[model samples]
Target: MDARERLAELVQEKGGSLAGLSRMLGRNPSYLQQYITKHSPRKLEEDDRRKLASYFGVAEAELGAPKEKSYDANQEWVDVPRLAVDASAGPGAANSAESPFDSFRFSRKWLREQGLEPGQLSAIRVVGDSMEPLLREGDDLLVDKSDRPFRDGIFVVRLDENLLVKRLTSQGGGRFSLLSQNLSYPPIAVSAEDIELVGRVVWKSGRL
Candidate 1:
């Protein structure tokens, strides 16, 4: 299709709106709409084109240049669903049973090196500071739902309808202590029957 059509497709692929992109680019909300739908400017200006391309992680040619090739054709990608729930690191957060709102694609080879299967993985945002210094608020975690055996590691647990992310330490007598990185919050003792292991937190991503 044409350049404008390609731009529209890229915005949709990124799960963003034209208005949002316009605002992100410091233009009026109608700027992208006018360019794509009205074609008032006929084509994107060089600077504007470069900005859009950079924001969308695409080549400038993909935005409008003729006889240009797309960059993703030869790339390997694996789509990981990002769930709408938050795994609280402190008290707890309400878990949402809804499906994913969006997804992120990672390199297939890289994921394999982590020994994780894309189908068995899901992502959730972390909330609270109990697990601070390692997992901060608003951090995203990749959980391995299949790894529910529960050894001594970080996990997402459901306790009394609240979802939590905490480090689990095995205690004798069929009990475990939910520990937090921050020393202010005391560890909580829980029986095996009192908590349900949701998944193991295999990876985390957020600001350093």
Candidate 2:
């Protein structure tokens, strides 16, 4: 795709508004909107393009800047988007906007070791104590968006409009229970068709 398309995708992926991003760039709130929709400036200014590339953690050329003949051969880290899922370990509305709030870098080797691809991964925060001890509140979790098969493990799922993070135990048939690590929280029996599996929780990190 072209620069405008790529920019639009990034903005949408982050669940952000053009006005907000324009403000961040110290431009008028309508700057991006007009630029994208109306083609006011025709092409992104160098400074604006640079800021946008930095903000999105992408190469400048991806947005609209001229590409170079060579890239850094020593680059070892790749960024994984941290989405604002605010997913609670218990039953809660995943109704909040799903967008990239920030990014964290991991070594390419480390990601490969975990069988994770940066394009298929996102990070989310635990919001409740339902899965305490094992998954504490305030923990940052790395979600593998590609692991959607039924498995007996923790997963981030969407039921109707609600988003949830819990463990799934297959029940022979196409059924499973949303299990909580903490016994205080009872299990929720659900059919596979009722819930939209978001992805599986693959890695977690947080304070002790």
The prediction achieving the highest TM-score against the true structure is 2
Candidate 2's residue-wise lDDT over 136-177, tens digit each?
Answer: 888999888664345678888888778788988888778889
- 72 Cα displacement, candidate 2 (Å): 6.4
Give TM per candidate: 0.62, 0.70
Best by lDDT: 1
Candidates' lDDT values, in order? 0.78, 0.77
lDDT of 2: 0.77
Query: Which runs of model 2 end up more than 4 angstroms from their true locations?
Result: 1-64, 69-74, 147-149
Clashing pairs in 2: 14-100, 94-163
Clashes of each: 0, 2
Count clashing residue pairs in model 1.
0
